[model samples]
Target chain A: MSTAVWNGAGRRIHIQEVGPRDGLQMEKAFVPTAQKIAMVNALSAAGLAKVEVTAFVSPTAIPALADAESVLRGIERRPGTVMTCLVPNVKGAQRAMGAGADELNLVMSVSETHNLCNLRMLRSQSFAGLQEVIAVAQQGQAAVNVSLSCSFGCPMEGDVPEQVVLDWSQRFIALGVQGITLCDTTGMAHPAQVHALVRAFKARWPQTPLTLHFHDTRAMALANVLAAIDAGADRFDASVGGLGGCPYAPGASGNACTEELVHALQLMGYDTGVDLAALTQVAAGLPAQIGHDIPSAIVKAGPVHQLHPAPASLEEIRSRAHERLQATANGL
Target chain B: MSTAVWNGAGRRIHIQEVGPRDGLQMEKAFVPTAQKIAMVNALSAAGLAKVEVTAFVSPTAIPALADAESVLRGIERRPGTVMTCLVPNVKGAQRAMGAGADELNLVMSVSETHNLCNLRMLRSQSFAGLQEVIAVAQQGQAAVNVSLSCSFGCPMEGDVPEQVVLDWSQRFIALGVQGITLCDTTGMAHPAQVHALVRAFKARWPQTPLTLHFHDTRAMALANVLAAIDAGADRFDASVGGLGGCPYAPGASGNACTEELVHALQLMGYDTGVDLAALTQVAAGLPAQIGHDIPSAIVKAGPVHQLHPAPASLEEIRSRAHERLQATANGL
Candidate 1:
């Protein structure tokens, strides 16, 4: 049947795997530096376009990723995969560049309340810090990107004004940022919101690439991704095996899963260019690495086309069915 | 902000709570008959337009639901609620009618492989059995609805042809079935497929009502629901607390959760006419009832608009920010 879903017109969506950084940072126990490096190396080899290696924030603040420099130094970076790292301030930016991060991603929240709570800095202070970081990155000849956390909504501040987000994007765009990633920090984004915001953001900055970071705390990440795709936004930040948990919501799921996201995109005629089979092997190995089960649906359910055979009782049931028919005929 | 999602023009979606029947059937432990009845009562009272109370399948087949007769007899049917129960054969139809079922739901799998395995009857035999059940229901003046299982795809047979589903729907419509529920038996239903099938179904049979039942095995149930909604299908079958599990996909999640579905639809401004607050409480008490935690996103993450206050550090953060700014100014 010629339908919309099966029409595999050669459309492509870019994926940035952030599990090593975003997912690993949320773990209570520190992942070994070697394991972290291996995970990042496996992810890069899996055909992912970008890998957020680790954050250069204060090691004391997030000791789980304290070995960011060592891990960055160890990983084998593939040619097409751009190795990115999060830098919260100019110092982090300097360290990230020294560690050889191809793209320096700076983090700030759109909501003043969230910025204050998350970074202990005023919104303007974080923005100004980003300017300094961007300047440092420019000096080092490193590409700079800005990650606008809680661009959707703040866990504490409720609904963020769209104008607040647009204004910050405009300001960041003026600072020569190469890419802007709007994050749903607590899975607060709805499809319509994603659709409207992505459309609005793309309309404002056609040249600068846009990315969406979604949490599956509310199980709407894929739905939100679809909405973003329909709005013509291509890039997304996903974690392999759906690793990570929300600090705000206890036991809340983390990002839109990388393999799951890729699986859906590939099925729907949009090419993600990531090897789902190899990517799943990476996800399959994550539980042993992290010592916990991941919440990725594809991992649990298998791919949509994976067939499960009929239960083995079919042989017995055939005879039983014949007996039942005979008995029914006799009873009638 | 007159955006697409904000413009809610009062489109209504009808939810059929199948937790008491479909969800519980998969449970290993037997929930008390009183508990089953109370659960059904609570669901019907929560403004769900339809509640599938219980199945009249043979007790020998499913001992967990052996008290189906007691449950069906004990539940209080509220006005504006259609109490439906599964009637597998003419005997089930008679029993369900005797217990005062408003709608007798006859089930058969669209896939021959599934029908034979699940029902121990060939596809033609299942169709003949449905004819007998429909005839019995007609004599009792009870409404008949057909549940076409594996209409999306079967685990045993991969990629059930869309034409197969369409032909079955045509036959069921010809048999005067008032409503037909297409079930994603193994979570094979994707959004685009759901959209195409829903659009095609509605176009062919405008008068016959259609309902969509989906499992969240691959976590696309809600996304598929949104796609179905966009394609003009309004009815959905959901289980409370995301109860139930697929026999096919071990450890896979169950149906689209009732409260989570209601939460998203309500946030999107679609009127479900079901009280989300009351529904969530019902879902909250389900882990105790079923002896396990459900994977319902709303149960875990709360509603989209439920605000998580900023950590109790507004005063401290403001002072800390002031000190950081003062230190920066002194350096400046």
Candidate 2:
């Protein structure tokens, strides 16, 4: 590792806000389509490089994000912000493109066990199916990004070999997919593991755009992000209010917090291009809308730069100290 | 920064638990003396390098830790674990030594405003007062560690100059104190700031043990620890279950989580000399004793090595996938 690894000074770190899609997918209360659009619109204007607006999966599968089409079409898109959405199959890809998604995000678990449990299909079936979906998505000229779940390690299966992740990434890259996201779905990725895998991925395909999605389940998300940055990664997926959690591991936090990550990067002199104040303001409104407390530290404790007023009793204390010092000096 | 900065391959990281003192100070409920003793005993047996057992300050000032002397004397002492206590003045230092504390931790804020507000004295007064307290503790043969609060940045006054921190550290080191803990009282410390400060501190006094104390108030504690390690810091102060909060900054987390820090370090191949499983177990029992939830991620999500059984529906999904694949192969 070089000094550049720890010092992000002037580096352009890409932040992809995934709250509208990944964060809301786990919510029991369905967010109104209007509210969903409003959230995405705010995030898009917050200078994020991308926003995973909504998932174009079956409404029955994830009723929480049932308004995928409405959300994708309704949100105001900024010129630099890529509006992306999860597309599970050919039909989903078509619907997502039809709804005006700039990028079609296809996902599958790297772990065979997780792939079967999550997608209800074998890994091979998923690969073949996604290949067809990619063809469909490319026909519509939408950029494609494949997100490999359990890329770090699977909760149930334990270690998903690093080769498996790279293999999936290599295959997706060969297919001309624009990007790949290595997701630590269960927050099982540690710094050492993240650095190694990221280095290997960059070594093999340095030109391919890579994004790291992390869960704060074990509170290693930020540390893992730092490690990835050290290993030449610049893009990250973060959720507003740190929303979303592993269904496999209940009570665990979801994605890395968007505001927290942006705040940190900005403080380190990284060019994150995120309006942290506006983003935190959006995150601050989440609890009221979602009807639950979020796991975001920034939403609770403002960014480090937000200074507090001195204690009101400071004057009294200062005067008392002054008096005591004078009395001692005068030999009273 | 070098690769050793990011890779803690065989480096030994020292974790000092400060939950019993720092964590409990903010709690309104008075933890029973017996329960406090039991908690300290459990932590001591959990293979921590040191545990800040309790604060020997005025019982009236912090009624929650009123039983500090009884709790300190009653806890079972482990041979390798050093028991330390916060001693604000000469009387407190004498009381701590009489109660069998292995180390007396003296504290003051680097920020003049914070020192006045917090200790109701000027920085010079606090320093001179603690020097006398140090002399008193030296007579009792107790090791001394000076903890400088708001070494990173003061919530009220904002930036505390790096020169100010180093100057205070130099003065204390000249007093022949055993160690100095740089306290990020409000979690304002960032990775860059931490790296620079720790690097400077280590450069000037490589032989004097330095401990980095951070808060997760802005969710940057773990990241700051990583940066400090990069700057040659090995010792850290963490609270069990991420206990403690800033009285000035409401809704902010207190200290870096002990189990989370140890778990991360161990994953990075650092020798933390901590029984993570035992520490997590003790942390798990905290909510019941404190009558509130703790912010420990490991206690909720378990360690990465703790494998979860595959989802119960996995077998069914596997069979379903097999049938679908077979049908597809037969072109049915």
Best by lDDT: 2
lDDT of 2 by residue, A1-332 (tens): 12665567799999999998999998988889999989999998999999999998889999999888888888896898999999999999888888898999999999998898788999999999999999998888999999999999988889989998998888989999999999998899998889899999999999999999999998888888888998889999999999988875677778899998999888888999989999998999999899999988898888888888886788988999999999988999
Kindly report which residue stretches of model 2 are placed more than 4 angstroms away from their true locations once superposed: none
Pairs of residues clashing in candidate 2: A244-A254, B244-B254
What clash count goes with each model?
0, 2
TM-score for chain A, prediction 2: 0.98
Give the range where candidate 1 chain B is weakest over 10 consecutive residues by summed lDDT.
B1-10
Kept native contacts, fraction for each prediction: 0.57, 0.77
Go through the candidates in order and give each one's C-alpha lDDT.
0.86, 0.90
Candidate 1, superposed: residue stretches over 4 Å from native: A1-8, A319-332, B1-8, B326-332
In angstroms, the error of model 1 at B271 is 1.0
For model 2, what is the alpha-carbon lDDT of residue B322? 94
RMSD of each: 2.4, 1.3
